[model samples]
Target: MAGVISGHPLDTLRIRLQQPSSSSSFSALKVLRSMASSEGPLALYKGMSAPLASVAFQNAVVFQVYAVLSRAFDSRNGRDPPSYKSVVLGGVGTGALQSLILCPVELIKIQLQLQKQASRGLGPMGLIRRIMEREGVKGMYRGLAVTALRDAPAHGVYFWTYEYTREHLHPGCRQCEENTTTTLTLGKMLVAGGVAGVASWVCCYPLDVLKSRLQGEPAAYTGILHCFRKSVREEGPAVLWRGLGTAVARAFVVNGAIFSAYEVALRCLSSYQGGQSPSPAAE
Candidate 1:
């Protein structure tokens, strides 16, 4: 939730920057200042509720699916470090499965974020009600294919990179998994997480651009392919890469905090199992 809150404003900016109306001259600072002047600072957090609600479920879905898939190969036990191939496969599966849930959540968020009038502060429930009344059920999952395309390979690369980077940072993590006294190197873990986050976004940002366009302006194009062709023809290939810098930057910060929090929670729970109760509330 903290990660979502902290990164959502930048996310809103990135989405706007990806829109067809934006261009090389549509600077992040300029857009931000425009939003602030037009809609107040809170406009930056316009679509937060849907994604905020999704954080726990999304992470749980990702990690849970990863755990199951990781354990599926070789003679590996629960404590063994998964092979990189297994990591990628697990992440891909996780991403595909999670997209079914995430698609609707993001559809609502995108609509809320792009709304011209933020003065009234439309809530998620209200926005959801409106979409249902007007566009029906299919509207909520408008960009599922594009979402899957963005997430599947991105998540695969993400899990692999995090595992690879963490192993490089602390080669002993695999050996120490079962040790109750073993402590993760906080600095190394955070670095690995940040790098992993950046890797995921860098690998699949163009698909994300399409997903945003498809959802935000569903009537503008037939589908992802149409959206892609139209975006490139009109804006050039470079348009797909727009807002990438903001995305990678946001990914690094938000995912660094998320992974660190996960590790802390895992440690706290492990300690509790050994008859110690440490508060994980700080996380």
Candidate 2:
């Protein structure tokens, strides 16, 4: 949710920048300033509510699925608890599967944000209804391929790095050796998640750029291959990395906060459900 809210404005600016006319007419900074001036700063947040709701629902579902799948595997393997690799794999699988739910919300949000400067009369609901009316349900999923392509790896890396750090960095964390009452620490997860976020962003940024362009600038691309070729040819290779800094910054801040909060939430919930008092880790 933090990621969705904090990043929307920048996301808007990014879409505008990809428009061919926007490239020659305005720099990214100018576009941001222009939007603020013309539409008010809140205009940059046009579709924020959907993304916030999406994030909350998606995270809840994905994490629950991951935990359940991991536990099932652990029981089947008789390993007492799963390995970090199993956890990471579970997370990857969850992320990929969740793309089905995620894509539509993302599509709606992107369309809404970009609609601020729309060359058409259709606003958010109108555009969505039109897509449903014209292209049926599938239109909402127009760029699912690239979304899955980018997110599977990005989310895989995120979970992989987080689990890997927890496995290796703190001796016996996997065994809960500090104490049964002691859950994973927020500070620790924040540090780990921050690192993981940076790694994920770097590894998957180009794909993200591709995904964004594919969704926000359909005329600019025919498919993923064509998107890459055209982005390079028209915007120069570097433009493919246009909002990388903002993305990385967003990942560092948002993921760090979310992962930390999640760990704390999970610990608290576990404590409450177990009929045990909250531990220091829940602090």
Candidate 3:
């Protein structure tokens, strides 16, 4: 929630920037300032409800699916610690599953975010109902394929980078010392998650730009490939990375919070269930 709120302004700007437009001189900061001046400061958080409401479920599905798949793969290979392949597979599975849920959530969110830009005068629910009335259930899932395309590799890199960073940062875990503490410190958690977040976005940002365009307005592009080709052809190659700066910035803070909070919660729950105090290494 904190991450979303913190990065929403940039996200809003990114969405507007990604919208198919003949005008190629769109600047992030200029767009942001224009939004603030024309619409109130609160305009930045126009579609926040969709994400805030769905984030918990979305994250739960992604992490749970990833964890289950990863564990299963590890057990199958008789590997105590899963290989990078297993981790990537798990991440892909997570992305695939999460994309199913994310499609509608993102549709609603993007529609709301781009409501002003698209000049759609409807609230979130109204927009949802309108889409349903006009395009049926499938309408809500405007860009599921591209979403999955972006997410699969993005999450693969996400988990891979996170695991790599965690393992390297706390080499003690590799030794498997009986008396060694395996607690994740706040600093380590932030660093690993932040790096993972940046790596994931940097790896898949172009796909994300395409996904956003597809989801934002279907009329702009015929299909995913069409959108890709048109984006490159019309806007030049730089258009593919329109909002990358804000995206990477947002990913760092959001993923950092996600991992840190998840780790803290897991440790707290384990300690409570086991009737034991928190580990000394978990500061």
lDDT for model 3: 0.82
Clashing pairs in 1: none
- lDDT, residue 260, model 3: 87
- What is the lDDT ranking, best to worst? 1, 3, 2
Alpha carbon lDDT of residue 192, candidate 3? 89
lDDT of 2 by residue, 67-117 (tens): 776665554555456766666677677778888988888777776777654
Which pairs of residues clash in candidate 3, taking residues 3 or more apart in a chain or in different chains?
none
Clashes of 3: 0
Q: How many backbone clashes does candidate 1 have?
A: 0
Where model 1 places Cα greater than 4 Å from the true spot, the runs are: 74-79, 118-122, 276-283
Q: What are the runs in model 3 whose C-alpha is more than 4 Å off?
A: 75-79, 117-120, 174-180, 279-281
Model 2 steric clash pairs: none
| C-alpha RMSD between model 2 and the true structure | 3.0
Please give each candidate's TM-score: 0.93, 0.86, 0.93
Residue 143 CA error for candidate 3 (Å)?
Answer: 0.4
Worst 10 residues of 2 by lDDT: 17-26
